[model samples]
Target: MTSNFQAKIEGLQYDALQIRRNVWRALHGAGSGHMGGSSSAADLLAALYFHYLRQRPDEPEWPGRDRFVLSKGHANAALGAALARAGFIDDSVLDQFYAYQSSFGMHPDIKMPGVEMSTGGLGHGLSVGLGMALGARMQNLDFRTCVMLGDGELQEGSNWEGAMAAAHLRLSNLTAILDYNKVQQSGRVGEMLALEPMADKWLSFGWAVREIDGHDMGAIVEALDALPFAPDKPSMIIAHTVKGKGVGFAEDSYLWHNNLVTDEVYERALNELGAPE
Candidate 1:
């Protein structure tokens, strides 16, 4: 907990706030969006793009760059915000969310400079990320692959298949961050499909697992620093987060998952999140 480290965390915290603010802006511009998942992932996205991943924003196609697949692609607003803040994309793109003929949409688009995978259908990102990890190993590249998944997305069953494969293959370069926001669209995740014993589930699949408060910048950074928690196993970080984090009314509510973002709602959310620099 050195002063320098604290300062670094502080900077990330600021970026996370800005990311959240931008999430609301993007959704407001689109008149609606998946605000719950997007805001829930902002802190981790900030830490990953700004501090953890070895990526070249100016040269997104660099072969040596790490790969990040947003498995919970509904949270693309946060990813877009992070990329913009990191200089991988122009800030104006945030206003184009869901616009007709716009590359930026509700989901991640591979054509987007920094987006490694075009994903929106749940339970697919892990498998794609596993392939990237395997490909990196086959090519003798030192690059790593990380995937961010939503709590509800795990119910798809494909994620477990990929999890099993990654563990069996011993892809240490692969990491999965589960944005366990607890609530999902329509209702609380447990109400729709309970993933109780979630940590145990990943452990049983033979992956190294760590649970952390996803919104805490310092904790998030520490967890990222301890990647590949085991030598021959892919790492799984269960990031406990809140749906619609940073906004009082929306927080923990499924209604805000992808609801309409009117002008009034936008201003209220921005007030809670503060002005973005």
Candidate 2:
């Protein structure tokens, strides 16, 4: 039997920690990656893949499986980790990050069995998620749709268009989770362009918004479980997270947003994150 929600939450938390480690390991192999955004999203990805998402990794093309759109393609490292943990692929793929012919690149590709949509361009997933939900509804299928968005990606005008469309269509079966880590490529989001009243923005855009500590397994799971948050509207989760979560040196900084990973840096990162216990 599948684990209950809370137990699944616990197990997924452990899984997420391992995912974090795997993300770094993958980057260690690649020698560099988008570690900041990737690690920031580990918990949310874990919750989605391991707990909430009705995905059978061994049978990834399962018709009734829920779909996930990783809007922030830069975070593909974390998503790949979660997919491997969920058995969608062999764990050895982590060592091939950024490899010449690897499917596991810096951005998600729909060609990957478990990856529903090819994403790297911000602001594209929400609209796609709306389409997925509407398609499920039309087919009378019970599948749900989810999309993960980056904080910096919100600045893209395309997201606003998607937001307006999703609400107007009332895609209650679709949910968007914002990995609100507050920092982006060159500097803190606030310092560059603040996304203040972020929750209210989603609410005004016609989503039932909820804010939570993104790293808290309980919070992540609970928010995901309370889907739609209303009978006739889509739901949005504003997950407050750290930029480079779980690693002391990388946490809350833009420098690590696109930095090289050296053996010494990797060692320090592992020390801060600790072993997956």
Q: All models: lDDT?
A: 0.95, 0.90
**57-112 per-residue lDDT for model 1 (tens digits):** 99999999999999999999999999999999999999999999988999999999
TM-score of 1: 0.99
**Deviation of model 2 at 211, angstroms:** 0.6
Worst 10-residue stretch by lDDT in candidate 1?
268-277
Model 2, residue 277: distance off in Å is: 3.5
Query: What TM-score, over all chains together, does every model reach?
Result: 0.99, 0.96
lDDT, candidate 2, 1-277, per-residue tens:
2468567777887898998999899888899999899999999998898778998888899999998999988999999999898889889988889999999998998888799999998778888888899999899999999999999999998898988888998889999999999999999998898889898898999989999999999888888878979988989999999988999889999999978999988888888888876
Regions of candidate 1 where Cα sits further than 4 Å from its true position? none
